[model samples]
Target chain A: MENIILTSSPTTPYFPEVSFDIDKGICEIRGESYMEETYKFYLPLINWIKDYIKLIKKPLVLDIKLIYLNTSSTKCVLDILEILKDYEDDSGQVKVNWYYDKSDPDMIDEVEDFEAESGIKIELKEF
Target chain B: MTSKTILSYKGPFYIELISVFGTNIRNFNDTYSNARKKLFKIFIELSQNVSNYSENFHMVNNVQRIGVGELFLKELDTAYCFTTINQVKRTDAEILAERCEIVNASDQMKLRELKREQRLNSPGEKFGARIGLIQAVMLSKNQLEYKVENINENFSYFSLTVKIDKY
Candidate 1:
């Protein structure tokens, strides 16, 4: 599968920078995410992940370092995590790491919520 | 709470304008830095609610879809209040009221649960408003106060308010 790479901006509809390498099995989602058309932006990344798990079956590392994400974007993130969780449950080599602002308690809670909802072990790294 | 209006605007909430508003709010009152992020988050949630779900929208140069609404930020001694108003269909008003009830009745933990439930309901906004409502309340840590002003037989103005207490 081709890698998905997109850069974010200092503007509205803050689409996060994404780099999903199918070969390397390293997917990193960074920056802010708050756009009106959230599904359109995330569906491909979600699909890329699914296809990787189904086809590649390599060691997958998903790095998420988003600073600000709206509720809609949050749902899409959870969906991505759920897909990874499934792959991990099946004894696939998968790891999820979330880097966050240590000073921002809200984001910490958000990362925890992602863990609780998806039943995934998201390693939290302080930024 | 004794508060005065720190910022106010009324017009079509295009994405560009929303970006400017966010920057201004982030730098609104540096003394309230603790509340800036929460304020910014709640503001984005509420304003996006207007830009996305307001029943009434117009075209910009026949190229862009613009949702018209009003936003106001009030600064008090202990908290900051944000209010938004937009036109909506009567049917939407009913749904908004129901969603508000769900958000208002829930505590922080329950609100978080509700948010997750609603989020899983749809990846395409079948329950988008529900998620946004729950999130605004959760981030603000305040009640979702609302009022419906009747405009005509089929439309009404939906006003929503949330307060972010200063830390």
Candidate 2:
């Protein structure tokens, strides 16, 4: 499968930067994500993971460095983590590292909530 | 309690305006303020709540529905009050008030749980308001303050305010 990349731009600040590399098994979503059409943006990322698991069967590392996420986009993040959790449960190798600004404690709480909801071990990194 | 007004706007809450307002709110807060994170989150959730569900809305190019509302950011002695007001059907106002009551009654943990439960659903016309309220309470660690002012038999002005404590 081909890789996907969406760079964040100041002109369109509603969406975040998304990079899903199929070969390297490293995917990253950074910046703020509160797009009005959240599903249109996130569903394909979900489907890409499904395809990677089915076709490549390789280890995956997901990096999330989001500062702001609306509730709807928050759900999409959970969905992505759920897919990873399922992959890990099936004896596949996957790891998630979430980066946050040191000044923001709420992101820490949010990552904790994601862990509680998806039952995935997400390492927190401060930037 | 008296509050110092920081910013205020009244008009259609279209997508472009929301983005501009969101950035303006962020720029208004200090980079080192511990309250910045919660303040921004509450601002986005509540404004988006109005932009999505407020009854008085206009169609943009006959495709997009942009809600008309007023948003205010005010500084209290110990907190920042982020509020939005908009016209809503009388029926929807009751629903909004009930949701506020539910959110205010829940503590942080419960609010988080409620937010998660409501957030699992997909995004659409039904996705924003309830979950946004829960997230606002969860982020701010404060009870929601709201009002429903009757404008007519079928419509009322719904105002929702949340306080983010400044540390």
Candidate 3:
């Protein structure tokens, strides 16, 4: 599978900066997410994750470094997590790391919520 | 006097309010990058509350809605106060009052925990109803204050204010 790379923009919508390297099996989603059309932006990313789970059986590492994300974006993030959780359930090795500013307690709780909802163990890293 | 005359007299006041609000937004450049993004999100959520759930008349065109309300952002010595005023039905006013009371009564840590629980339980499609107030309070990292002004006995005007610390 090919790698997916997209830069985050403020003017248009909340499309997070994404880099999914098929060879390395490292996917990083960072930056702020508050898009007007959330589903449209996130559908491709979800599809890509599903494709990766099917085609590539390598150990996957998903890193989240989002600073600010709206409620709509949060649902899409959950969707991505559910995909990862399914892959993990099927014997695929998966690790999810959520990096947040140490000062921001709200973000920490948000990450924890994602972990609880998806039933995925997300490693919280303070930065 | 005629209705047209009355509207014409009120036109300049409306123009002045818009100009002032625009100027406030324009002059807001303290820490434009991150703070601006946060401000935009907060404003969108708060204003949309007035549009979607408020009993007041809100203009809807396509998927976008605009509500008649006043938003003020004032910079103090150490923080900024963001205030919004709009009309709401009595039931909405009661709900908002209860939510604001709960938010104001809780500490930061408690609020964070509450938000986490709510986020996990919230169904994906429904937005702007449950989490908006909580999100606004959390985003500002400050307490929320709300007041209800009785507009007759059936409806009321709700005012909410959130303060953001400058860091």
Candidate 4:
């Protein structure tokens, strides 16, 4: 399977920096996302994950470092999480680690919400 | 070129000025961060709604279609109050009112659960209207209040206020 790489730009509405390493099966989505067309921007990322699950079948690690995302972007993030959850349910090795600033309690609460909503265990790491 | 009439229509813009002034806070840096993020998010959502659904203008960049709106942030003694003002068609106002009622009625826990379920089941592109508002409230840890004033026969001015307590 080919590796998928996308660099996020701040000029756009949803400015998220993405670094997905297909070789190591490690993907990181960071920065702020408040795009006018959120789902359109996230579709490729979701499709990549789905394709990876079918082909690579490796342990997938997701590092989330989003300091701020709008409600629309949050929904898209959840969609991405749901796909990962499905992979885990099929017994594919997957671990999601959410990194947030220690001083940012809002980010922590958001991660917790994602955990409760998706029923996927996410490791919260404070930096 | 009389100065008096030139500034007489300082209607909604005045409210916008007030909202901008309220954003200045002395303490609680964390609260400021959260409020600023939420304010930007709200601005995008509300402005898009005006652009997409408003019947008066079909073209995306038409100046008339752009909703007249302003956001104000006030640092109260113990809390920060954020307010937004915009003009909406009467029909849009009704729909907005219904959505606000539903969001205000739900508890925080319930709203979070709803947001999660909606995210999973909802098609990625077609995000429902009220969900964004509900999620914003939940994320900000604040309560929202709205008032509708009849303008002409077919339009009304809608003002929304959200308050976040400083901890």
Please provide TM-scores computed only on chain A for all of the candidate models, following their numbering: 0.94, 0.98, 0.93, 0.91
lDDT of 2 by residue, A38-117 (tens): 77788889999999999999999999988888887887888889999999999999999999998777888889889988
Interface alpha-carbon RMSD, every candidate: 2.4, 2.7, 6.4, 5.3
Estimated TM-score for each candidate: 0.92, 0.92, 0.69, 0.76
| Highest lDDT against the true fold, candidate | 1
Worst 10-residue lDDT window for candidate 4 chain A reads A6-15
How well is each residue in A9-115 modelled by candidate 1, as lDDT tens digits? 66644778989987778999888887777777888988898999889889999999888898888878888888888888999988899999876789988888889
lDDT of 1 by residue, B107-136 (tens): 998987887677666645333424777878
CAPRI class of candidate 3: incorrect
| Candidate 1 C-alpha error for residue A110, in Å | 1.4
Q: Which ten residues in a row have the lowest lDDT in candidate 1 chain B?
A: B121-130
lDDT of 3 at A95: 98
Scored against the true structure, residue A115 in model 3 reaches a CA lDDT of 83
Give one digit per residue, the lDDT tens place, for model 2 in B1-167.
77799889998887677887778777764652667667877787778777877888888899888888999988878878888999999998888888889888888878877866776654533363247778777777888899999998999999888888876
Q: What is the TM-score of chain B in candidate 2?
A: 0.89
Error of 2 at B17 (Å): 2.0
Off by over 4 Å in 3: A1-10, A19-26, A54-58, A99-106, A116-119, A124-127, B1-61, B66-68, B126-129, B139-141, B150-155
Clashing pairs in 2: none
Can you list each candidate's DockQ?
0.48, 0.50, 0.20, 0.33
TM-score for predicted model 3 compared with the true structure: 0.69
- Which has the higher TM-score value, candidate number 1 or candidate number 4? 1
